[model samples]
Target: MNLKIVVTNGINNLIKEDYIYSTDLDFILLKFISNDWGDLCNEDKKFQNELLKNPNSKYEYRFMGVYLINNIKVWIISEYNYSIKSLIMTILLPEEY
Candidate 1:
């Protein structure tokens, strides 16, 4: 996708909490940028697609992907906030949200 990968606060937390390997982190960001949606079910994937099609006021653009790391499930989310003129991406365990 020739996309720029963002390393967000949640990713920093993932590194500290899990000591996650670089390769796994690479896969997560790559999959996220490529729209691979790792472990998401069809319904969740559909929601991601819908979000892209119809973003809300809070987030001008957004995407979510689920992936498994050492048997632990995590979610990666990226959002563009028009108000702040920034793009933010995050990764964390679902419960953290």
Candidate 2:
């Protein structure tokens, strides 16, 4: 998708501390990119879709997805960063939000 992805130190440490396989996280991110939005409710899905409609909105909007990674619930947020002029996605646990 040619997007810039980042991770938080909290999640980074969890990945290492819990021994979560990278492949599993990669697969979850794939689902996020595909708009699976795994565990999001109907209202949340609608909000995500609304943001997607704003490719030209004055303010940058974000697309968020929640999914299970290695049996742990996680959130993947993708947003357009006006400063960088690119899509930025972040992988983090709910607490990290």
* Residue-level lDDT tens digits of model 1 in 26-73: 888888877789988999888777766653622555678899988878
Q: What is every candidate's alpha-carbon RMSD to the true fold?
A: 4.3, 2.6
How well is each residue in 3-86 modelled by candidate 2, as lDDT tens digits?
Answer: 788988867887779756667779888888777788999999878777667655324666778877667888888877767777
Q: List the residue pairs that clash in candidate 1.
A: none
Show where candidate 1 strays beyond 4 Å. 1-19, 50-59
Error of 2 at 13 (Å): 1.2
lDDT of each: 0.72, 0.77
